[model samples]
Target: MNQEPTAQEPILRIDGLSKSFGPVRAVDNVSLDIQRNEFFALLGPSGCGKTTLLRMLAGFETPGSGRILLDGTDIAPLSPEKRPLNLMFQSYALFPHMTIRKNLSYGLEMERLAKTEINHRVDEIMAVTDLTPFAERKPEQLSGGQKQRVALARSLIKRPKVLLLDEPLGALDKKLRERMQLELKRLQHEVGITFIIVTHDQEEALVMADRMAILKDGRLLQCGAPEEIYEHPADRFVANFIGVMNFISGVVTPNGSFEADGLSVPMPGAAAGPATLAIRPESIAVSMNGGGIAGSLVDAAYHGLDRVLHVKIAACETPLQVRVPAHTSADLGIGSPIHLGIDPDRCRLFPD
Candidate 1:
């Protein structure tokens, strides 16, 4: 999609945003517009300024220079508590002394809400997060997954305009983390509120976001839908960062194909130059007909779902990974000679 319908006003607009500490810049000239009820994510490595940008949105960090517009009004100078947003930290940060119900009601109580109002809101939040049974449970007695729900319930109880999450699932194990990803996405859709999440885990961002922004060294490298970012990455950095890729460096040929010594691969409509051709391992096809690029398999491993083959092509310095069906491993083996081919459309070209 070219862009979301922007004729409608954005719930949040950030323009020329920047933040610096001494000479070090954390966020640099970043601008973004998040639509109402959109599930947006900031994705990058640990030090790539995604967290800092999320903090700025939550009003926890002040921007050195920029304009933050919420519902068409500037909120740059507003205090964090006064802003119409809530931040869920990575640690959950639950008060150990309080019960789950108390934790959920803490924010409302601070607002000087009447006792009945607090009780009603707290019960409602408990139902939404499915923590109704564990309302009186202490943080120390809950499982990792349960604690995550408690944190989510606490932040969302107020029904803020935008909910910001900073690595909220980072504390869980692999299996639990994957499960929570689906839960979070479902909750976001059900709530119909703008959800902005900051995460270093690429899979988490891709699974949860309607669209994601990639940051690197305090710069916004690219922004697009999950499929767009994965299939047509903007550059080498994005391709390598989002997932595993087999990079082949070769000079562009006369017909817009890539030629690396004895190996020649077609690059449809690609410009002529010294370029890097990227192909995901899953996209490669192996043929027994002795066609395509000739390579000798150096290693093969069975991974339950698929068999991974590392092929070292002639005249190429690095090996290319080929994934074949798990059952096909009986036909292909280590040190076996094979030919690898990929559709021209599957190859991404980046000029050097």
Candidate 2:
């Protein structure tokens, strides 16, 4: 007997989804599955279709093509209110005139849920979100973070199958935004609801997402764990997008080996052709004693726990950045001779 694989199926699946606005294609043939209770992020630069994709999932925009399957059933034809989902906007769109408690209860009130049920859910969410004390305060009275919580509490009060957030913390200061990233991740686990967030901030996506999908030019690029994509990027674009990647032009030899800056790099996956070798700043070892690849220090910057040293090599035109602990660095000035220790095994090769 054929059985439905409900147990292992992803909570949401986007199959070949695409959307176009007149002459512009906002999203193109994108497909990815999001697991149940997963903290997933839709990461990309501005105008890269992440927000458009989120809107499509929330029923705000119609897809020009493809299927949006939620729990194995297509939700494309369903209207915003009919779908079991909620969209939290970047503006933290709380009703200014309504109190925090009233704002949280608005959705339930519209659904005509029992007064008792609405009160219980609103109070419960306020307590969970630490907004209990500010329950009577209006959105104008609360701080940015507290208002953000109220908006989040309102979105979560509905207990939808999935929660879609579009740059939920974009308005907060850097410190607050970073703090809220952890808070949002913790809240997602506490409620056990699948969260799909759209953002252009790579650090936010890397810090918050259990898994993430990268989109560019309306095309799906790569999707995987933060560390997985960072450690082994699928291509050059991805390598440069996630973090600070040091790229040096190189070539694959006829013997199926690669070399960069006159130093041989063993990239087993690279074929014989022109390629670029990529290595993280921390991967290269730098020293003033001069033992490895010799280069001149172009610039150095101290960032509390670590220091980044930029070196210019004779074989490479661009300055290569090397990261080392702050304590290990000496008082080396500009144009000072330095040595870089690069392990061939640590480098990644990408074809040009």
Candidate 3:
């Protein structure tokens, strides 16, 4: 008899999940699978329902329809306390009167774990989160980053199968937030638990998540690894939403390329009729000599890291943006003649 390979089932599966407040659909028929040990992000703008979906998964808000399964068991009907998961709220939700030790131990006490076990777990988590020095400090006494660490240690102490974080680092400043992103990623790897984070910050989601799903109007717009989403957006909305781009509307030529105004560039893929070509500003090449599209320099912005030149091509109505090295800022001037070119393969076409 041949032995069958062991299958690793998803840690959580949400099927046909929907929720509504009156006639407004907050979470509209959302379904997703969270694989074990995967760091996934639910990312979108404010009022896009990513947070609501995360809340429903944590059992804080019940789903009106469909089911949620954890380890292949129906958990939609289960209470938050009964589920094998923990949620770190956006505000950290640490008790103002409680010390860090008490905050970390509170969950264990609720479960009525032994004192020794709770102490051991607290110590372990404290070490990992670097919270040992502030163990006895209350939330009010701790710094914003320290407080965040406490909240994280509290959540991880329970050793839940899944960890859900709702804007957990929103309280910290820019420097601290960037630092904690790497720290949190390291912590997640150390613990080896599935993490589902909900955030409106695109950079945060892209930096931390192994894979992410973009939510808009309570619907999933795209789901894939960060590189896939950045390189191959599903549509114009996703393209504009995720990063900066310069759009040029053109008609697909018989030669499989597109032309608009004075610039004719080869399109990357097949699309017919009126179409819009999207190219990243950085993809554009600018030269002072006789090459590429001829245009007049309209404006330029110096961002320290790079310089962006705005050019008005004779054949196009919209000005094209070209990003160049900051060192070239002194060489180029307004009204200076320039030429721009892009690799044929870098252009992406979308039906208008």
Q: In lDDT terms, how accurate is model 3?
A: 0.87
Tell me which residue pairs clash in candidate 3: 261-315, 262-315
Give a tens-digit lDDT track for model 2, residues 1-352.
Answer: 5775776789999999999999999999999999999999999989999999999999999999999999989999999998899999899889998888899999999899999999999989988999899988889989988988888989999999999999998999999999999999999999999999999999999999999999998999999999998998889999999999888887898887776665776666568989988999999998566688889889999999999999898668889889999888857889988888888777788888
Q: State each model's CA lDDT, in order.
A: 0.89, 0.91, 0.87
lDDT of candidate 2 at residue 342, scale 0 to 100 = 83
Poorest 10 consecutive residues of model 1 by lDDT?
Answer: 1-10
Candidate scoring better on lDDT of 2 and 3: 2
Query: Ten consecutive residues with minimal summed lDDT in candidate 2?
Result: 260-269
Per residue, candidate 3 scores C-alpha lDDT tens digits across 1-352 of: 4653324667888898888988888888888888889999999999889998999989999998989999889988899999999999999999988889999999999999999999998998899888999988889998888888888889999999999999988888999999999989998999999999998888898899999998888888888888788888888887877767778887997667788777788764576689888888888887766788888899999999899888898666768888889996668889988888877777778888
Residue 82 in model 1: lDDT: 92
lDDT of 1: 0.89
Candidate ranking (lDDT, best to worst): 2, 1, 3
Which candidate comes out best when scored by lDDT? 2
Please report how far candidate 1 places residue 24 from its true position, in Å: 1.4
* Per-candidate count of clashing residue pairs (backbone under 3 Å): 0, 0, 2
